[model samples]
Target: SPRFIALCPTTLSSSSSSGAVDEEEQRLRSDLRERFLRTLLLMTDKQVEFNMHEKVRVRARFGASDIDVLNFQVSGLETPLGVQKEALLRCQDVISCSFEL
Candidate 1:
């Protein structure tokens, strides 16, 4: 197997104008980040896989490394406006998403 490399690795946390981080979201982000950083940060170009027509998680390919999603978070950009609608729609399509370790 090829050794994974961190092209731009750094620690990150969430902050809002109100400076409050939702615990659940924080946990989810933390979990995703932990999974991502433990391996390699697959480039952002990796395919966006639809696991159940509703659940969408980026899949890291050959050139990509497993990366904590937070590692890819923008410094100041906020969440998407329609993100909630999309998430709700996804949830309706898939009961849950499971990742392979």
Candidate 2:
């Protein structure tokens, strides 16, 4: 999967000659991916503010992301021009996103 590959380091260190280190690295990557997915789940249906490139910022109801995490589906997106009832934001363009607990 591209997502899994993207989450991993492209190269291994010289010390990674041991299988144990490879296993540990894989475990850590799995843990990180799980935590990220959990955070996204917690953000579901909540109001989220997304800070994007070019200093663009928008607020919208958080929706689901694709399996690849390449895009986000949102509702009531308030852009500088006007409010968009629904929109898909590319993850590459987004710098960060946040929501209140």
Pairs of residues at least 3 apart in sequence or in different chains that clash in candidate 2: none
Regions more than 4 Å wrong, model 1:
1-21, 41-101
For each candidate, the alpha-carbon lDDT, in order, equals 0.34, 0.88
Query: Tens digit of lDDT per residue, candidate 1, span 6-101?
Result: 421211223342234455655776797677565444323332332344334432222322222212221121123323212212223433333333
Taking all chains together, the TM-score of candidate 1 against the true structure is 0.22
Q: Could you say which candidate leads in lDDT?
A: 2
Q: Candidate 2: where are CA atoms >4 Å away? A: 1-16
Best prediction by TM-score: 2
TM-scores, in order shown? Answer: 0.22, 0.81
lDDT of 2 by residue, 1-101 (tens): 65545655542443456877777777887898899999999999999999999999899999999978899999999998999999999999999999999
